[model samples]
Target: MIQRFKASLAITLAIILSFTAVFAGPKDTYASTVAVEAKSAILVDAETGKVLFEKEADLTLPPASMTKMMTEYLVLEAIDEGKISWDTTTQISQYAFDISANPEYSGVGLKLNKDYTVRELYEAMAVNSDNATTIALAELLAGTEGEFVKMMNEKAKEMGLPDYEFVNSSGLNNSHLDGNHPEGTEPDATNLLSARSAALLAYHLINDYPESLEFSGQTTAEIDGQKVTNWNWMIPNMPGSLSQFGYEGVDGLKTGYTDLAGNCFTGTAERSGQRFIAVVMKADSRPSRFRQTAKLFDYGFQQFQRKELFEEGYQIDGESELPVTKGKEDVVELETNDSLSTLVKKGDEENYTIKYNISKDKLDANGKLVAPVEKGQKVGTAELVYSGEDQYDNILSKKTNTVDLVTTSSVEKANWFMLMIGGIGEFFSDIFSGAVDMVKSWF
Candidate 1:
């Protein structure tokens, strides 16, 4: 009878565990399908910079006018720094006039010598995809297109945008113009860029210039009282158009096309307060570009979602307090260089844990820190760990999230020479006093 009861209890426990396992939500799966024409693509969370999906994303390919994205980025940077303002007016130069005349190659049709506000010009450049307006804005910002190109390249380097090169403010293909130039003609090569770099540029621009959406996302605008329409037809006509996709939060981005480069696009979409950037390059046709982009965006929104791992200004375990050798303060604090946050799935928090490992050392007596301390100092590391029976089932599963936690402030090192001299003087004084006391006692 006892054996039978024990067997029955075991059977019940096994059944309950099996039921719990079966009822748990489905594990994450990377469900993606790329059309044959797509040569390279990438999708990323604009907030966390997490790459959700990618195919040949780092492969270098001609970006066509998508090069204009960088031009747009620099222009916004100029505005933010107060170098120019929306109402500021600029004259149309001869170069700008030339570019506007070539309709096949130019996106703008501005009349030469006409003055337009910085605001109007930005709309013409971004909304209409105006090449002439892009050149004009670059010249106005840097005195010449060449100087502006230099600034663009410099900014690219600073941003770690490797594999990107800008020979002109507008990424017009320059191979046709090369060696055919008259004396003093600036070399024109269509701006060449990769899918990854283009996405990076889009990511940085939207992040840096949130206000730029008012222009790029605009389907129609009146500049100098003239109506202009945006070139990005996907915003208005695509099946999962920004409005239809419920990506009303979507804004500011650009598109590109050239016979050699095929159709290329870089766009951002936002929903429920989370923004994502998607890039598709070298599609077979204009329509296909939209289709491919839609698919990529769908895959991102459907397959993954962003979750906050930690709140900003939330303190994780810091380095153990270290004794200050001779300073007024007894201890120093350590923290992360920035706040800790990550993109996570809907119900994975229960399996995640944050772990901290800090160094054990005390500051010296002379208020000197040991050698090897660096600015934005990193003295320890923190990691996030996920554990469950089937944690590895998901493609985006993360076993741990690690970040460097560094010293929050600078540590002043003591002058060893001064300390040595002071110590020596004290020792000699003590010896002299002891000898004098001994002589006095003998007397």
Candidate 2:
């Protein structure tokens, strides 16, 4: 998988360039992990999806308001796809009005027959955790909230979420409300999302629809003449907020709480060019959720440093590069038009391996890439893994990143005579390569 990533690149190429390029050792569980009180928790590298730390990540649990992240995601997706404009007006259906008034749930007080723009409802749903507004948005987009939940579930499947079941667009279970359920809706409905899935959903939201942070991260907003505060306490100035906690980098994400699920927060922060997502589900208290998240971010930011493994559009500096067959040139300069980066500990790049994900069968026995290599054409990618004793490393010690290596100059099919000459050269080169490895082993 040629997953495009951005990190720091400080490791120098040590051997001949190949289809396989590795950075450091394979990473597993990171060390010195901070214990979180949540029932399920995961801290991941936002760019690389590396699970730096996790506890019962796949154990499914009620997501509560964190489920609203999905609700707002579909809304933003519609706005981006031009299906609905921010100004697109939607009516507050009788069902939405019932949920707001009868249950007296959190909302901007959406009333029956009142028309609110998509932007207003979205802000209410995301920032204020307004249940009525989210249901309204869901019904407007999918004809009914139930249908919209189906879409949400489908999206979760598409995103490879380990497990997710969205009960309502509002993330409200029947138990949370004291009043009657809307006529057609099931009172027992509730969303279930594991920490891994929550972090994954947050990843899609922050990366795909960055504009969402504008709403989720805000300390407060106003809709329909009502002042609303973003429930995410990580944001500064929120009610009884933990913004005083050291991490000002905590920008945007979601928070949730319910009778079934304790206080849960899926948090993200960027410091020193590194962005990390930490999800703590079912914590005993709201403040502790942020506190645990803060500890996770501290572990990530302090222990990990961003490294650029391969720079995008950066030319390979080596003059004696590898040969390419069936091309006009006997050899071609290789460089990456796309960059890749990873997060590694401060000083662990000393002996990393280049794990080439390339299909070596495409190369001649001499290990030369076959011809028709076009400029900017991706022949293969180089992944940074580990070598020597470092192969058994984990997240804190190794950072895995991959970058596409393309031809700096295009290579066309050579004449038949040249092909024979290249084949012979490859044969000898392979032997020499093996011999060189044998000699190096002796040393």
On lDDT, the leading prediction is 2
* Local accuracy by lDDT, each model: 0.66, 0.72
What is the C-alpha lDDT profile of model 1 across 1-443, one tens digit per residue? 01223323433644564466455442222222434347777777786566666655555667887888888889889888998988899987776777777768644567876788888888888887877788788889988877787788788777666457676766666554334222223444445566677777887887788887778888777765677666666564433343343234446578888776778888887777777788888888877776777777766676566665654333555433444433334455655554455555556567766665664542355544464344457666666565743232111223235677666555565467855766788899999999999999998
Model 2 Cα lDDT, one tens digit per residue, 260-295:
677999999887667899999888897788888888
Question: After best superposition, candidate 1 residue 436: deviation in angstroms?
Answer: 43
Query: Which stretches of candidate 1 lie above 4 Å from their native place?
Result: 1-37, 175-188, 236-248, 309-341, 345-353, 359-379, 385-443
Clashes of each: 8, 23
- TM-scores of all candidate predictions against the true structure: 0.67, 0.75
Cα RMSDs, all models? 16.0, 11.1
- Give the TM-score (vs. native) of candidate 1: 0.67
Worst 10 residues of 2 by lDDT: 1-10
The lDDT of model 1 is 0.66
